[model samples]
Target: MTTTTRTIPFKADHVGSLLRPERLHKARKQFNRREIKAVDLRKVENEEIKRVVDRQIEIGLDVVTDGEFRRTWFHLDFMEHFNGIEGYVPKKGYQFADGVETERYDVRNTGKITFNSKHPFLKDFKELNEIVDGRAVAKQTIPSPNQFFNAGIQNEDIYPDIEDFAQDVIKAYQEAIQAFYDAGVRYLQLDDVYIAGLSAPDIPFNDGKYTREYLIDLALRVVNGSLENKPEDLYVTTHLCRGNYRSTWAFSGGYDIIAPTLLANEKVDGFFLEYDDERSGGFEPLKHIPKDGPKVVLGLVTSKSGELEDRDEVFRRVHEASAYVPLAQLCLSPQCGFASTHHGNELTEEEQWNKLKYVVELSKELWG
Candidate 1:
C-alpha cells in the first residue's frame, strides 16, 4: 500500500464508553432503590461526566465523551429511549466468555418504532455540550441501527415481516442522526456489536431464516441509510467489537467475513475496529478497505485488562496493517471501551486513564 501525507483527525481516539466511577455507580444504585430522585441521580451523573470530560482533554485527546456515565448498558440506555421501545428484564442473560452472563435488562419493540423528538439522550448530549464548551469535540455514542435486529425482541404481531422492522429501524436511526447533529453534536459514533457478531464463522442464534450475506447487506443498508443527508461537517463513525461485558467477549472472529462490504461501503468518516487479541484474527481483511474510504482506527491495545501493551509491538503491528491501508489512513485506540456496560472491564479507573494516556502518547510519537 502507498503512503499519504494527509493528516488524520483524532489520531488518538477511543471507542467512547469509559469506566464508571465508584461514586457514580453508588448513586445509580441508590436511585434504583428509590432512595434518590431522578433529578438527584442526574446531578451526580453530570458531575461525574464533567470530571471525565476534563480528564480526557487533559490527557491530550482532541475528542471527548460523557464517558457514558448516565447509562447502564452503553447501548440500551440510548436505544430504550426510542418511541415504541421499552426496557424490560428478561429471564435469561447474555452469556459471555468464561461463563460470565450479563444482567437481565434489555429492550423490546412494543409497537411501531420511531425517533422520539424529545429523546432523553438529546438532553444528555446538550448537557455534555454545555460542559465541553468547545474545549474538545463532544462525541455522542449510540448503538447502531443494526443492533436492533439482534439485540432487541421484535414483536411479530406488530411487525410480521422482518423487512418492515428493518425499515423502521433505518428510519428511526436516520432521524436520530439528524437529531444529534441538530443538538450541537459535531462528532457522533455508533457502537455496533451486531455487525461484528455476523463476522463469526457460525453465528450463535441463527434461526436459519436469513443468510449471513443477507444480514450483512441489511446492516449496510441500515447504517448507510441512517447517514443519508447528514450534515457535511458532522463527523460520524462506528465502532465494532464482538462483545464487551465485564471484560468477557461474546464472539470470536476477524473482519474478513464482512470486510468486503462493511469496510468498503459503510458511509461513515471512520471505523474503530477491535484487534486487541488473537480472537479478533488477522489484519489481512483490512486490505478490503478502500484507499479513500473511512479512516481505520486500529484498536491494538487491550482494554479488558490493566496490563499495558508493549509499545514496540504496537508500533510494529501498525506498520503491518499499513501494508493493507496507507499509514496516513490509520489511527490508534483501545480494542474497545474500558467499559461497554456500567459494570466495566477488569481494570480500575486509574488503569483506564493510563490506557488512554498510553494511546495519546503513542499517537504523538508515531504520527507527530
Candidate 2:
C-alpha cells in the first residue's frame, strides 16, 4: 500500500456525455443509420464538446470531461466503440422495478476485446485534451471490466465459465488503459454498477453456499485482474453505484455489506462511493478504509435531481466521515452523473450546473 501525504483537493464526476443537444443527437442517429458519414457527426460533436468543456472550466471545476458528447450513454457508447463486442436485442428485454416502469436493454457478448486505434474514444479524449485548460485536470471514465463481463451474458445465456470471459475483458481494458495513458490521460475511473449487486440478497449470485462475500471476491478478482501490471502513473479508481437511470435507482444496499472487501482488497487509487442518500448506509463502514491505501471520494452530493444540498449540512457530513479516514484522504462530488444515460435524467441543464457548483463550493470549503 502506498500513501501520499500530498492531497489533491477537487470536484468532478462522470461529467461527460448526454449533454448532446437535440441537433447532435439527430446527427448521431443519422450517422448510426449511415445516412451521413461518421466524420460529419464527429465534426459537430467535437465543436459542441469543446463548448461543454470550456463551460466546466469556467464554472471553476478542477477536472473536466467531454460531457460524453459523442456517447449514447457511458456504457453502451463505449462498448459500441470496441470490436469483438456486438449488440443485439435480447429475446426477453431487461426489466427494472423502480416504482415507474423501465426496461433494460440487450447484454453485451465478448465477440472480441481487441485494441484498435480507430476507436472514437481516442479522438474524444484528444479533442478534450486540446480544449480543456491545462490548469484543470482532465479525467475519463470507463465501464469496469466487471460491468463489461456482466454485460456479456444476455437473457438466459448464463456463462457456464466466467473466468475465460473475465480474463478476456481484462486484457481488452488493459489495452484500452495503456492506450489512454499513451494519449496522456492521468485520472481514470472504472464505473461498475455490478459492484453493488454483491450486496443484493435476492440476486442469485449471493445465494446458496456462495455467500455475498465469496461472490464479491470473484467480482473484485475479475476487475483487479484486468488492472494487473497497469502503469504506475495512471491514477485508477472505481465508482460503486446501486444503479442510476433517469434519476431513479435500481438497487438499494449499505456499504457495510461490501466495505471490508472493497476497502481492503480491490487495488486502485481510490473508491468513489454513492453516499448521497440513506440507502448507502452510515459512515461506520468507512472505518474499514485502508489507513495506508486508496483515497475515498465521498459522493456526498446527489446528482439524480437538481436539488442543491444544504451547504452547511454537506460540510457536517464531510467532517463526520473524516473521523474514520483522514480529511486529507477525502474528496467530494455528486453521487453519480447528471445523466447516466441519454435522457440526461430529470433535471434541467441549469439544475445540473447548480448541483455541480454546490460540489465545487463544498470541496473548496473543506480542502482549500
Candidate 3:
C-alpha cells in the first residue's frame, strides 16, 4: 500500500458551504417564488459565488469551493438530482439537539437512483472550476453513500433486497465521482455525517429489523464500493460530523465506535473529523487510525457559533490529538460547514470570515 503524501493532503481545508450572502439568498427566494427568471437568478448566484471563491483564494485556502450557493440544503439539493427522488414536507421538521427544529423536509425515491449527466451540482462544480483559474484548487463535496442509507427506505418496495439497494446506491455514487473527475476535479470530499451519528450514545440506530452493526457494515461497504476504480490522481476525503443546523447539533459522541471501521478500513485519502467541543468526546478514538492510513483533518474550531476560539487553546488541542495520530498525518478545519443550509448558523458573515482567517493563520504557523 502507498503511504506517501498526496497532493490534496493540504494543511488547511473547509467543509465547503458558506453562509449565503443576503443578496444571493434573496435572489434564490425570488426565483423559487417565480418572482424572477432563472437567468436572472443565475446572474446573481454567479456574481456572489465569484466573490466567495475569491475570498477563499484571498484568504490563502488550499482548495476553493462555490460555497454551495446554488441550493437550500447541502445534501438534499444534490440528492434531488437522482432520477426518482423527491422531497415532501410532513407535519414535523428536522429535529436537532437542544430541542431545536426547523422546517426541513424528507426526501424519497419513487424509482431507481442513478446519476444524471445534467446533475446541477456537477454543472455547479464546472462553473467554479472555471472561476478558480489555477489560483487555487477547486474542491467538490457530495453527500456520502451512507446518506442514502440513513434517509430510510423510501423505495423498499422497488428495492426489497437491502444488498441490491446498496449496490445501486454505490453505482450511482461511483458514476457521480467519475463525472466529477471528468469535469476537472482532482479533489473531492464525501460528507458522511451519518457515520458519526451512529457513534452517539443517545442514538440507538437500531430498529428491530436491522442492528446498528449491520447497518454500519453496509455503510462501509457502500462507501468503499463507490470509491472503487477511482483515478490515481483523485484525492477523496470523508468528513464525519454529529450534526449542524443553525448552531444546534443532532447527536453527541466521539469517533470511538467507528474509528476502527471508518478510520482504519475506509478507502479514502483523508478524514475531516469534528473535534471542536465536548460533544465530540475525546481524541482517544483517533488511535484506530492506522500509522500509514489516510491523513486526518482535525476540526479544531467550531462552526456552529461565530465566537472565536483562543489560538493557543486550539493549538493545544491539535497537539493533544497528535499523541494518538502523528502530527504529519493531520490537517485543520472547522467542525462543520458554517452553513449546512442556506439559513446558515447563528454567526454573522464577519465572524465566519474570522473563523476561516484563524484557520489559515493557524495552518501557516504550524505547518509552514
TM-score of each: 0.96, 0.89, 0.96
Kindly report which residue stretches of model 1 are placed more than 4 angstroms away from their true locations once superposed. Answer: 1-9, 204-206
- Candidate 3 lDDT at 257 equals 81
Off by over 4 Å in 3: 1-5
- At residue 146, what lDDT does model 2 achieve? 75
TM-score of 3: 0.96
lDDT of each: 0.88, 0.73, 0.84
Best by lDDT: 1
Determine which window of 10 residues in candidate 1 has minimal summed lDDT: 1-10
- Model 2 ranges off by over 4 Å: 1-18, 30-36, 97-104, 110-113, 151-159, 207-211
Instruction: Give a tens-digit lDDT track for model 3, residues 1-368.
Output: 21222557588889888999999988888988999999999999999989988888778786878888887887888887887787777677778877888765767878988888788887788888888877788889888878887655357898888898888888988888999999988889999878887788777767687887887787789899999978889999999977788888887888888777878899998999998888888989889888977889999988988888998998898899899999888889998998888889999988998899889999888888
* Rank order (by lDDT, best first): 1, 3, 2
Task: Evaluate model 1: give its TM-score.
Answer: 0.96
Ranking by TM-score: 3, 1, 2
Better of 2 and 3 by lDDT: 3
lDDT of 1 by residue, 1-368 (tens): 11111332389988888999889989989988999999999999999999999999999888888988878898888888999898899998888888888998899999999999999899999999899887877888899888898754789889999889988998888888888889987788888899999899867545677788888999999898888878888888889988999889998989898999999899888899999999889999999888978899999999999989999999999999999999989999998988888899999889999999999999999999
> All candidates: CA RMSD in angstroms?
3.3, 3.7, 2.7
TM-score: which is higher, 1 or 2?
1
lDDT of 1: 0.88
